[model samples]
Target: MTAAHAPISAEPRRADFERWRRRSRLIRTLRVVLPAVIVLIFLGLIGSVAWSTFNAQPRAAQVGDEPIRLISPRFVGRDDKGRAFVLTAESAIRDRLDYQRVILKKPALVLDENGPDQMRINGADGVFHEQSGKLELSNGVRMEDAENAFTTAASLFDTKTGEVVGSGPIQGAGGLGEIQAQSYGVYGKGETMVFKGGVRTRLETKK
Candidate 1:
């Protein structure tokens, strides 16, 4: 014969059931609320980034009447025939009247660096017109190529037409000899030059 089994208490089992129910409810609530909190944080970060971008100012907008300064400003472009040209300035300032124009200090221009008509120009100061493709140089302008050298008080360059014209007196020296004129002009990408207005030339004779 087997001994009688003790009766199991229902109270303990009921308590265990209640505790399991509470734990399950807490896990479900966290599953829903945790994702919501994460989404809100992500949206806040995105909004902050957008606000900062909208309030930022551009480089050009910051310029004022005090003259924007640039160091070693350079411009590179091609002519009508696809010939490369370069313009560089030690320093540059934006024009007060027109924002599209720039004033360059100690500017240098190079045209067709590897071509037969390669030329280099230097000037104390220059004005560059962006829309018109015009460049004006002053304060003792000088130019040189493989065969000739020129000096002028002022000069103008037209990038569109590849022409360089003088505004004041000019002096030149080449294989032929010394030349002086009231005005001068260069065309054909520095292959041809013309001197005008009271021209004086002295050609050297071979001994």
Candidate 2:
């Protein structure tokens, strides 16, 4: 009877001790794992931010709120008869991406008119620049105005003066005559053309 009474009292103490041991283990595990989880999350956030900074693309500069760019080869203008004028390139590159463009090469220009009226213009080996109101053709260039039925050479154009002046040799034919000169100047809106230096003209006679 005495042994049985002692065993019953020890059973409750053993159960209480087991419960306390489990609680202690749970607290210890949370204390160790919570800090480890927080550190891992902090490291992950740092790595993500660093990757975004290093791999990001730089922003392109803009001109007047409009991005500075070069246009691709395209039909930009029309002739008097409402025909299309196209730019023909030996090799053309077009990029509309993000409204930022870059172009290269001498592009030939073709007029909309037919036969002798159809013209082709090509610039010398150099970069062609397009400005606000006009196109600047430079570097040993040639223009075949088929409408006028002539091939002329020129370096610059003055829109106000309506003139084209050649920096080198120019040879061409018009409705009035055939011309050859060391330098040539043509009134863009008028028929008055002046050829200088070894100028020669062959007039077309009426039959």
Candidate 3:
């Protein structure tokens, strides 16, 4: 009896081994690349959401639906003798229902070419209703008395005696005096402007 031996081909074995190695490399490459792609997609989605949430907004000035507007306005306060003692800027917004009523009470004073003493504030925008007889001005408050000018964010002036009292920045110039006050109380019933708290006054004359 005789046995037959099979011949081995190294070329076939090498080809098969090369094919298997290529497939294995492809699978391993996918394992690393697929997770990296998924992580990038997740981060992109999160970034898009955060950007939309923060940037989506609008700035607003007025809160409600109202149709009232005012241009440059001026005001004047008079004394019992019919002489102008105080002058102020007049600007405000009000409901239509209360517009005429408000205007009639606190008329804006007309300014003379000369200055405060000869000025008249008779045009009205609103009235002061408090029993304490205080006048209030908001939104660009400016007051001019003779050579003096005082401006503030807002103010409370005494309707009875033309005095100012409140907490706000005030600047005034007149009668050889320059005043800057953080808070002030003006008693025009007297003859001088009084500055309170961090008051800086430059006097040009004593008399």
**Which candidate number has the best lDDT?**
1
Q: Decide which is better by TM-score, 2 or 3.
A: 2
lDDT for residue 38 in candidate 2, whole number 0-100 = 100
lDDT per residue (tens digit) for residues 1-207 in model 3? 899989987999999999999999999999999999999999999999988766653212233345365544344455443445443334444445554322222334333335444322232333443344455555456666555677666666565565556588877676778888888665644345667889888989775
Measured against the true structure, the TM-scores of the candidates, in listed sequence, are: 0.67, 0.46, 0.41
Per-residue error for 119 in candidate 2, Å, reads 4.3
Off by over 4 Å in 1: 1-63
- CA-only RMSD, every prediction: 10.8, 7.4, 12.8
Candidate 1: count of backbone clashes, pairs at least 3 residues apart or interchain: 0
- For candidate 2, the per-residue lDDT at 61 reads 31
lDDT of each: 0.88, 0.57, 0.58
Better of 1 and 3 by lDDT: 1
- The deviation in Å at residue 57 for candidate 1 is 17
Q: How far off is residue 122 in model 2, in Å? A: 1.7
- The CA-based lDDT of model 3 is what? 0.58
Instruction: For residues 117-138, write the lDDT of model 1, one tens digit per residue.
Output: 7888889999999888888999
Candidate 2 lDDT over 89-139, as tens digits, reads 554433334332223357566554464345556674323333321344555
- The alpha-carbon lDDT assigned to residue 166 of candidate 2 equals 67
